[model samples]
Target: MASRDDALRALEDRDWSGAEVDTSPSRPAMVVQSIRLPEDLARWVEDEAARQGTNPSVVIRGLVERAARPAGRTDVVTVRRTELELALHQAVERAIEPAA
Candidate 1:
């Protein structure tokens, strides 16, 4: 098995083709441990992702990203209830409409 540094170097080489690399300081990789969910919970996650037209891994990643976001981050915005309702209505309409 390749070492972590070797893997990252390979990725960097593939991403950068002779471009001057940034030597700026960067944080070390934080290992995220994975867990095996119970069968029922795993099924629910998959169902929820499918219902939202996304993959389970994407749903999981989004949840993690949301949780990890720093407090008072001005970059994050909240959706109004009315906007959510309108979006839901549009989605339903699109779903029922026949393809041209």
Candidate 2:
């Protein structure tokens, strides 16, 4: 068995041929959770997930993340419109845009 000093020396002298260091960003750990929703609301979430080409869990997570953010001043909002209306307007504009 090698001593600690000897092991350190061996590692220092070891050749590095094809070692690849990971460079990807670390993600926050997540825990699985369950919640009950009204039938209509659950359907809406599923529909939204389908429209965005994502799973219902992603839709729920986005909604939860948005809700968890700190609230700002309610006096004068930049967009005084419902999210559904804003999405509908954006969809319409995208549909009307000419092809490049």
* Best prediction by TM-score: 2
Write the residue-wise lDDT of candidate 2 on 1-100 in tens digits. 8899998998889787878999887766789889999999999999998776568998999888778877873453343367657667768877998987
- lDDT, candidate 1, equals 0.80
lDDT of 2: 0.81
Which segments of model 2 are wrong by more than 4 Å? Answer: 1-25, 73-100
> Whole-model Cα lDDT per candidate?
0.80, 0.81
Candidate 1 lDDT, 23-56, residue by residue in tens: 8877656666586999998998899787666678
In candidate 1, stretches whose alpha carbon ends up further than 4 angstroms from where it belongs are 1-34, 76-90, 93-100
* TM-score, prediction 1: 0.42
Pairs of colliding residues, candidate 1: none
